[model samples]
Every structure is written in C-alpha cells, then in structure tokens.
Target: MPDKYEAELPDEVHELLAAADKDREIRLTRAATAENLKFLELVRSKVKDVPLFWAVTLLSHPELGQAASSTSDKEVFKYLTDVELVQDAHDPREYEIVFHFKENPYFTNTELRKKYSLPNGTKPAPADGTITDEMRAFEAIDLEPSSMTIEWKADNDLIAKHPRKLNSEDDEIIDGDIGSFFHFFTEKSDIMSLGGTIIDVLAEPLEFFANDPSGFDSDFDEEDEEDEGSIDLGDDDDEDEPQRKKQKKERCCHP
Candidate 1:
C-alpha cells in the first residue's frame, strides 16, 4: 500500500511537500527560540532573589541530581549562581552551556562552559545513504560528546576526593566515584542520552523551582510564612529577621 501511494505521487509533489514541511519547521524553531530567550532573561533577573535557586532545581530532579549524590557535589553546587545556554552566532545547530559560579572554596574560575556541535555541522547519512530534509534540521541530530576542564582549588578537586577502584592486572583505575556532579564539568556527558530535558529545564526553570520540596526556606520564621508577600529573598524590609524562602516542590525531568 505504501509503495502504491509513492508511485501515485509525482516526484515534484514530494519535493513541494518536503519544502513546505522544512519551511514550517524553520518557522516553529524561530518562534520557540525567541520565546526561550525571553524566558531565560526573566530567569536571570529573578533567580538571584531566590538563593540556591539553581541548586535546588537540580537536586529536586531525581535524574539530574544523580551525579551530585555525594556531599561534596552538593556543597560545590551551592555556589552555582547561574546556568546559561549560548547559541553560536554563526551556526544555529551549535551552542554552549555556561555555568556561572560565585566566589567559593571549590574553584577559582567564575564560569565553566561546554560547547556542543555536530561533526562538520551536519548529520551523517543513514545506513541506506538517504538524508531527509527533516534530518537536516538542527533538532534532528545528537550533539557530539564534549568535555571541559575545571580549575579546581588545591585539595578541592571533588572528582578526585572520591576513591576509585583499580584493575588488578595492569593496575589501571577503573571507572568509579565519577558520579560527582563536578564530573559534569570534567567529563563528557552523553548529551544524546540527556535529550531535551536539560534544555527544557533551562528554558522553564521556574516550573522546576516550584517543584523543589527541600528548598532553602528552613531559615524563615513561621510568622513570615503566614504573609506570602513577606517571603521575598530580595526584600530588605526586615533587616534583623531572616528572609522568608520561596516555596519549592519535587519534580523530575529525566531524559
């Protein structure tokens, strides 16, 4: 039945349909990209007011926090001020993930980034040697795996803090204790496995922030909680009182 339909449709008709589909996809991508930029700007503006906003967001997600299960990983994460995704000015398919950190005992650098791109800036042909216009879309290909180096402070290398087991034969170190979230900076993450979850979380961080149950609100007084407006982290109304922390719930965005 599929072959019969293909035979009935002229090659020109197929070409026209493919062109229309590509145009529609480009339009949708552009619209989504614009909205994402706006959302990110909003997050940047409001996130500082909410202390540990990004840390709580990551920990609340079971899949995302899997790498930060260790105590040191959590501690280092406390300094993570922001996470920004920057698109390549030239190649729409390429982008970088930049992590902004405040002055901390962990590292000296203020920012760490990881760039992702497809080989030759294009997806490879399938086994059948056919590449559809759909395949040419930026969203269609998985980014090649990449890694970045973290300038760890003396004795502050969290990835090395955890002990690793060695093979008995050649005495080579086997994969171990690399689950530290710090490894996210030092190691090559299989972004393909991560899929769109990372992007989704960054694009809509507030939704994830709302899901952090163990948020940084324990310092707030019970009376402050009574007044919803009193829970502003940025407000300096009560200089002596502890600022009321925002509410958070548990939510996951595993790929």
Candidate 2:
C-alpha cells in the first residue's frame, strides 16, 4: 500500500529524521510514524465492522431498519468479517463500504408488469413509474433502486470520528476516486444499506470514469469511420449499375 501520508509529508521530513540519530527530533519522528501506522492498522481491522446481512436485509425491506436499530457496532463488524466482506482502506481500521444492486435477466417484462402494477400495453411508462422487467428482477434479487447520490462527506466524517492517534486535522482526506470505483462495483451486488455510504465514497472515481468522454472518444471515432465506410459501399453499388446494364445489352446482342 502506498504510504497514506507520503503525499502530505514534506520530503525534508524524512531527511530530518535520518540526520538526527541522537536528537529529540528523531525520537519525535519515530514516535509519529509508529502512531500513524498503529492508527492505520486499527482502521483496517474495522473494515469488516459492518454487517453485510443486516445491510442487505434493511435494503430489501427498508421496514427492517427498525429491527436493526439495536444492532451494535461490534456485531455489525463481526457479520461483515464473517462473510469476508471487508472494505479496502488506507488504514487497517478504516474500511470503505460498498453496497451493490444488480439487474436480474431471468425475469421477463410481463412478469414485472404483473408484479409491480405496471400500466398494461406499455407505451413506455412515465419516468417516475418506469420499472423495466430487468429492474424488477434486480429488486427480487435484493437490489434496490437508490436515488441517493454516493455521499462522501458521511464516510469522511465517520473516519474522523473514530478514535485514532492521528489528529483529526491530520487524517488523510480519503480520495473520492477510490470510493467511487468501489461503489460502482458494489452497486452491482445484492447488498444495500446505510453502510453503502462508505462504498459510495469509494466508487466516486468509477462513476466519473464511466461518464468521462475521454475514455469513449476513440471508440466513437471508430464507429463513425465504419458508418462512413458503409455509406461508401452504397455509392459503389450506384456506380456499378450503368456497367451492369452495358454488360446485359452486349450479352443480349450476341445471343
């Protein structure tokens, strides 16, 4: 893992530590490093601190949120860890959480229309009521539609609130890019909950990449070229028509 603080720490800071073998500065530097490492380890340990089952349950039946209201942090942690569903974090105790919802292909449009009270004879329903068969199937598989944009602030606050050696001010700003990517992948899974907030933070970059024009520009250009080539083929056929008529006339005369 990249050193969490490497980017923030000045280059001279390490040199200062190396040069001062017997000085108080060296002792302070060593102590700081130890403290930071320990803090990160603690964060890693908590990556699985949230319960995946509870998250899924609550997401599928949001009504169950009341039942899980009493769930302790340690219980949630154990559940997540038991299932080997841990978030990758810069520190051991800090975990990025991901919640995913994926579409199920098995369910047909007719089934969804019947199940969700969709308007009959689909001329395409209104945007608010638009639930495709695939979307309904996804819901059946425990994936829920979320209008919630991934909230990074919540994750940042959660990390900051955790007891650690690093000062709140010194806490590394969790990169939004990592959080977004994690969320993008997780959103495809059958889990959901408030814990998804963590995953959303990780998936920000992924969402950005998906929408970014730079990545798709080349493919778009290739497709355009292929379309142009097809148009040229149509022109070629038109050009060949007169020659085909001439050959037919000659053959008729000879016969």
Root-mean-square deviation (CA) per prediction: 9.5, 29.8
Please name the candidate that would achieve the greatest TM-score relative to the true structure.
Answer: 1
What lDDT is reached at residue 255 by model 2? 3
Candidate lDDT (C-alpha), each: 0.57, 0.26
**How much is 4 displaced in model 1, in angstroms?**
16
Error of 1 at 187 (Å): 2.7
Superposed on all Cα atoms, model 2 deviates from the true structure by an RMSD in Å of: 29.8
Clashes of 2: 23
Error of 1 at 10 (Å): 5.9
* Candidate 2 lDDT tens digits, 14-75: 76654443344324433543554455345335534432322332212211222122223112
- For model 1 the TM-score comes to 0.64
Top lDDT hit: 1
